[model samples]
Target: MKYKVCGRLGKNLKAGWLALVLSVLPAFVVADEPPEDPAHAHDPANVWFIGRGGQLYDSWMATTMAEKPWGNHPAYPAIGNKRGYPTWRCKECHGWDYKGKDGAYRYGAHRTDIKGVRGVLGMEPAEIQKIIMNETHAFTEDQLPHSAVEMLSYFLSFEQIDMDKYIDRRTKKALGDFDEGAHAYQSVCALCHGYDGKKINFASQKYPSYVGSVCARNPWQALHKIRYGQPGTGMVALSNVDLGIVVDILSYCQTLPEE
Candidate 1:
């Protein structure tokens, strides 16, 4: 009887020790989690780095909540439509397609006629950082912290996708299964975008551009937003999911309301 009691006590102690170890492990394991503050949430995960980097590349001001610069960037050409805050964005000059003059933004309100950053795709991050910090680019430390720049460099180096492969630039259609995409969207996206995806009107009540309009007009931009999230918004980046799934979501979004 005493031996059985001791055996039971041994099992209890073992279980108790296991529980204690399990409780303490998460704190150590999750130490690398991004901070609660949005500005400081530079995640270390490879996919998260890509997401944050993409957001920063999209709009550093929106990503870091940094104050807008006073005037047009010194490097910004007089021919460029974007001035001041907008010009500061990496994409303003480079194009969402990452091809700059060679890609989608070659001629539009967003055009700068500048060469895109696609050349830097396989380049070293340090070299890219130097280019961003140099006099030609001239991004100041106050406007963008080194950490933020690191994210940008990481993104520019690794995050760009050949959007043309997945989207038909002419027809502006996604090369994905609408039926499979519907399931993914209804399950994952409907919470914010709604069943019809008219929950948020991006343009305004008059024009009333919703997910469909944006996706149809610019599937490349929409895919980027889907994978990295919208800046200054609570939109969650779908980085951890499969690329196929992301494209599928884009296909479904294309079917939503435009106006």
Candidate 2:
């Protein structure tokens, strides 16, 4: 009689364990719920805003800190060396692509070693704009005008671009070609850079050499300058020119002497 009871009890125990497992099945099913997609994902409206913002920022960078570093105003000092608004241009730090030193300046003197905002894709817009106004980003809260700050912040908050894929380091060549680039340069850059592509003394005490100096040293920088127009100086953006024209200009400029 005892032996018979043991066999029956074992079967009952197995059945009880199975029932317990089945009872919690709903929890396991719920745990498998899908994870949330990135905040920027799938929404074309958001994409448009971010893209437009990015273009504006890049265009502004092209104007302010692009290659010249001292655009629109002759009196302004170098970006990193200066202590004012002209230096506060975003291109001075985060770069045209918003990648900062992590981007175009990864190895140059301007290199900041900072990460890109593109990395923080899901961050709140306010938080992103704050970063731009912060010392770590633009670093000119006091210098920047309220309207400038607000407008720049609005663009920065929405603008986000991944530039790592676009720029190349080894060849020092930007994303585009340098052949057609010559045409655009001739139209605008030729005046300053010169016909020989050996004009402008970027290193001189008074002015910078536009020739091969900047392009050879920093292609991405050259691209930014060409696209955005040097900050604090009279250099305005030639966005109308094809980016390929920029590359050609750089390629041709490289033939000039570094000294």
Best by TM-score: 1
User: Local distance difference test, per candidate?
Assistant: 0.81, 0.53
Off by over 4 Å in 2: 1-97, 104-112, 120-127, 134-142, 154-166, 205-208, 240-244
Candidate 1, 1-259: lDDT as tens digits:
3544368888998899999999999977744332233333334566676678899888889988999887888878888877667888888888887888888887888878889887886567888899888898888898889988888877776667777778888888899989989999999778998889889778767888888898889887889889889999998888767778899989988988787
How many clashing pairs per prediction, in order?
0, 26
Off by over 4 Å in 1: 1-44
Q: Please, what are the lDDT tens digits per residue for candidate 2 over residues 1-259?
A: 3544358888998899899999889666643221233444226554433333433354444432333333333322244443533344456556655676566656555555655555545455566567656654433433443444444554444333343444566676556455655565677777876776665666665555655777777666665556546545676554444445655666666656666
TM accuracy, model 1: 0.80
List TM-score per model, in order. Answer: 0.80, 0.54
